[model samples]
Target chain A: MKANKVLINTLAIAITFMTLVPFVWMVSASFMHQGEANQFPPRLFPETFSLEHYLRLFISMNIVRYFLNSVLLSASITGLSLLVNSMAGFAFAKFHFPGKESLFKLLLAAMIIPAQVTMLPLFLMMNQLGLINSYFGVIIPGMASIFGIFLIRQYISSLPDSLIEAARLDGATDFQIYWRIVLPLAKPILVTLGLFTFMGTWNDFMWPLIIMTRESMYTLPVAMANLSGEHSQDTELMMAGAVITVLPVIIVFLALQRFYIEGIMLGSVKE
Target chain B: MKGKRLFKVWMSPALFLAPALLLIAVFFFIPVVVSFLMSFTDFDIYSLADSSNARFVGLENYKNLLSDPLFWKAMHNTLYFVFIGVPLSLFVSLGTALLLNSKLIRFMSLFRLAYFLPVVTTLVAVAVVWRYIYHPSFGLVNYLLSLIGVSGVDWLGNPNWAMPALILMAVWKNFGYNMIIFIAGLQNIPPELYESAQIDGAGRWQELLHITIPMLMPTTIFVSIITIIGYFQLFAEPYVMTQGGPMNATLSIVLLMYQEGFRWWRMGYSAALAFVLFLILFAATLIQLHLQKRFSTV
Candidate 1:
């Protein structure tokens, strides 16, 4: 039994290391100076690490612009999506509309209709609105997702109605009740949903790749794909770009992982 | 009294739902309808320059799609991806979940975090990293293969290996998510069942086969459905890694749509492609649900 336990522990360690090697290699390769990572035998560590690639990215590649665009776009989308989705989610959960159940059911069923189905018409719509090649193009369609609303509604529905009733008796307005009573009560789900929106907007590639035609408006992943096209042979530099694109998400997930993981579990359990 | 209360409820729900519903209708629903309409007409580069140039092509684009060998290639590639990728990911997720859920496992949190880190990372960046890892001459993958006397195969450049490579990366990136779900499913299984099996002189393998597998079926089915749906929509990886290239071996349905719609501005044809994909996904989802119902009834 003791031998079996040791073997199992060893296997777990091996698997963990295997899982981490790709990310570790990405980080390590990013630190290597140009030409350092391309050596035979695949150097696990750079002989003399330098920040030159990162410097080059910000100075030569105008990556700072792309980085800022990503940050600003992700922030705006997250904030606006949270506000819109939470209101909708709260209504679905707590309010008793004539078609509340049916509407909610429709949204749930519509979830399976992949977002790709809308891309063509959405692009035309954006073009018509003059939002194409603008940040608003990427931000508009994503401002309120059915999934976000569903997630929030599922969490908020469990909140006690007594709280809202007491607030109403105090002559608090519906908006006030939502702001003071419901929003605060649903903080955990809000954070989780917010993280989902932020990460999703940040990581999104294809939509931005389509809509954001101008180089200046490009988000990180879109910019990175463009950069890769131009600099595919620049392995070390490409690694630096990948690191920049992936690092913020990795950091955010590490920081708020409890909520993120909980969100996934929540989604799964409800199904 | 009931009328007044009903009115109040209606007003509140309307107020709450207005923003999200409006966004969905304007952005999602309207576009989907317009795209469907556009697919019936010949909306292409000529139409872009002058809307008057567009004409009703009827089934011309759909007919072209059927004859277009590229479209068939994409269909085959996407089907291959879904058929192979889904089960492989499910198996890996289940295996990892069982391992992590084992009582003897130590440092479970650390292991869980390690496995899950890939899922949350940006796909474009991960694709970029994997692109490097697949480099024929000097990549880590090739280097590792060399140690075992295996010649370095051009992973992305080769038509035969490109889809499989993408599938491998996808599975690596996604399995952790379902693994987390599977872990939850595993934990919910009653320990008494395992104990009773053990009391019957069953070994660990028998207990797992008899108890754990049966109990986890519902979770597995749900996971498989979602995974299949997600895999069918493959785009960014091929767009970034292969550009659906080396003979169009990696062109997925969404990638095909993107090319026709955005790259070539064949909006009408692209919309039809999108609808076809939707039909396929809807059919698959219904089939899974029906199977689940049948199994539960039995």
Candidate 2:
């Protein structure tokens, strides 16, 4: 019994180390001087830690522009989606309206239809709207999502109805009830949805790859992809670029993980 | 006063729902319908430039897709990924979940967090990192292999090895997600059942095989179905890492669709490919549901 316990612990620690090795190498290699990563029997640690690669990424590769673009685009999507999805979610949860049940059901069914189905037409539509290569091109389609609305709806439904009713009885308008009562109460889910939207928009590759034609408009993922093709030899620099692209989402995820995990469970549990 | 109140009641919901509903209709539903219609037409670059150039050629794209070897290769590759990747991922996920759930483990959340870190990181970035890790000469993987007297093999460069390489990276990146789900499922299994089994002389293996697997069947089904669906849409890994190269060994169905749609401007053909993929996913889900029902009845 003791032997078995020892084996399990040893295996767990080994696997954890193996799992984290790539990320550790990514961070370490990003700080190494150029060409140092290409050495045989690859060095896990940088001999002399330097920020040259990071500096080059900002100055030479212009990764700062892509970083800023990702931040602006992701933040806009998150903010707008929170507002749009919360309103829809709140209405679905609290309002008595005609076609409410049917509409919500239709939206639920639509979730199965993969987003790729709409990508072609969305690109064309954006082209016609002259939104291609514009920030709005990326931001517009993501302003509201079915999953976002569904998540908010699930979270908002669990709140006590008496709260909304009391507010309503006190002469609060529908919007006022949502703004003053539901918003504060739904703060946990709002943060969850906000993190999800922000991370999703930031990590988005295909849509932005299709829509954003100009290099100047590219998000960090797209820019990194383009860089990989052009600068395949610069492993350290690419690592630095990867670090820049992935760090913000990791921070956001780590901070709000409780809400994030709760949201996942809420999403998975069939009502 | 009653009429005014009714008007306000009716308008409030509409006002609240208008923005989200309109966006979904215009950007999601309408585009889905348009894309489906587009599959029936010859909507190429010329059509894109001038709407008049597009002609309705019903079923032709799907027919061509049936005859296309590249499409079959893509299908084969995707199935290989789903079949192999799903099992491997589930094994790792289930294993880690069981380990973390073990009474002997300390700091379970820390271990869980470490494993899940890869799932949240940017795929494009991780794919780029893995590209280097698969580097023939100086890669961490090859270096480790060389330590055991196994000469370095070109992971991504060799056609035969490319898909497996991708599958490995994918499993590493994904197993954490299903691990969390499996942990929840594991927790739901009552400890009393285990205690009774222990008292009844049921060995660990027997108890696990009989008790744990059967109890976690529903969660297992859910995880596998989602994992299969997600794997079918493999794009970024190959796009960033291989570009579906080394003789198109890593060319996933979605990647093929992407090339035809965006890169080559065969929009109609690509839309057909998209529909084919959708149908496949739909059918797969139905089969799993059927299997789950059958298994539960037994």
Candidate 3:
């Protein structure tokens, strides 16, 4: 049993190291001078440190513009979707109307329809509206997501009805009750859902890749893909690009991982 | 006063729901319907240039898709990924979860965070890093192999190895996600079941086989379905790392759809491919549910 415990501990540490190796290598290679990353026997660490690639990315490549674009896009989507979906989620949780149950069920059923099905027509629709190659094309479709609505609705429903009733007795209007009582009390799910939306939009590749056709409008992931295409041989430069692209989301996730992980659990558990 | 108050109550929910519901309707619902329609029509660049140029080509796209060798290749490649990758990924996730649940493991949360770090990183970055890591001549993988007196395999350049290379990276990127879910599942298992098994002289493996595995079946099913759906849509890794190359060994359905629609402007055919993928996912989900109902230990 002692030997078995030792073996388990060893395997656990080994797997953890192995899991982190790719990320470790990514950060390490980003600081290597050009061609050092590809050396035979693969120098695990740079013999001499360099920042040539990061300088190239920020100075000449002008990656800051793409970085800001990603940040602004993700932030806008997260903020807008939260407001819109939360209103709907609040109503679904507390209000009643004809066909309310049916409508909610329909929305739930629609979740299975993959977003790819809507991409073609949505692109064409955006083109007709002259929204293509701009943030509008991305943000308009992102203003509401069914999963966001469902998650918020699930959390809000679990809140006691007495709070809303008390708010109503205090002559709080419907909007005021939601804006004041519901939103604050539901802050945990809001953060969880917010992190979900933010990380999703930040890491999103496909929609932005399709809509943001111009180089100036490219998000970091789209820009990263273009860079990798144009500079496949420049391994060090690409690693630097990869590092900066991944860093912001990684930082956000690490800072709020409790909310993030709980959000996943909430999503997986059936309502 | 009663009527006025009733009207206000009626309007409240509608007002709350309108913006979100309208956006879903216009952007999501309408597009889904239009895409289904567009699949039957030959919607191409000329049609985009002038709507009058488009013509309905019912079943032609689907017909051609059935006969298309590349589509079959894409299908074959995707199934290879789903069939082989899903089980392997689940195994890794479950194994790590079990290890983490062990009392012997210290700093379990730190290890969990390390494992999950890849899941939250952008796939584009991960794929690009992996592209270099799979380099035949000077990659870390080959370098490590050389230490074992093994020859370096051309991971991404060789047709036979490219898909496997991709699968390994994908499993690495995704396993942590399901591992967390599995860990959650394991915590939900009643300890008494294990204790009872121990009292019955059941060993560790026997306890796991009898109690833990059966207890975690629901979570396993849910994780499998979610993983299958996500894995079926494999695109970014191949797009960055392989470009679906080395004889198109890693061409996925979505990658093919993107290439056909956006790159080639074959929107109608692309929509058809997308629909076929949806049908497959729907069937896969239903089949899993059916199997769970039949065999559910819970």
What are the per-model DockQ values? 0.83, 0.79, 0.84
Q: For every candidate, how close is chain A to the native chain A in TM-score?
A: 0.98, 0.97, 0.98
- Cα lDDT for residue A119, candidate 3: 97
Instruction: Give the alpha carbon lDDT tens digit for every residue of A33-148 in model 3.
Output: 88988789787777789999999988998699999999999999999999999999999999987688999999988998999999999999999999988898999999998999
Off by over 4 Å in 2: B1-9, B291-298
- Which tens-of-lDDT digit does each residue in B272-298 have in candidate 1? 899889999999899888978876776
Cα-based lDDT at residue B128, candidate 1 = 92
In terms of lDDT, the poorest run of 10 residues in model 3 chain B is B289-298
Q: Which pairs clash (backbone N, Cα, C closer than 3 Å) in model 1?
A: B39-B268
Q: Write the per-residue lDDT of candidate 3 for residues B146-227, one digit (tens) a residue.
A: 9999999999989899998999999999999999999999999988888888889998889888888888888888899999
The docking quality of candidate 2, as DockQ, is 0.79
lDDT of each: 0.90, 0.91, 0.92
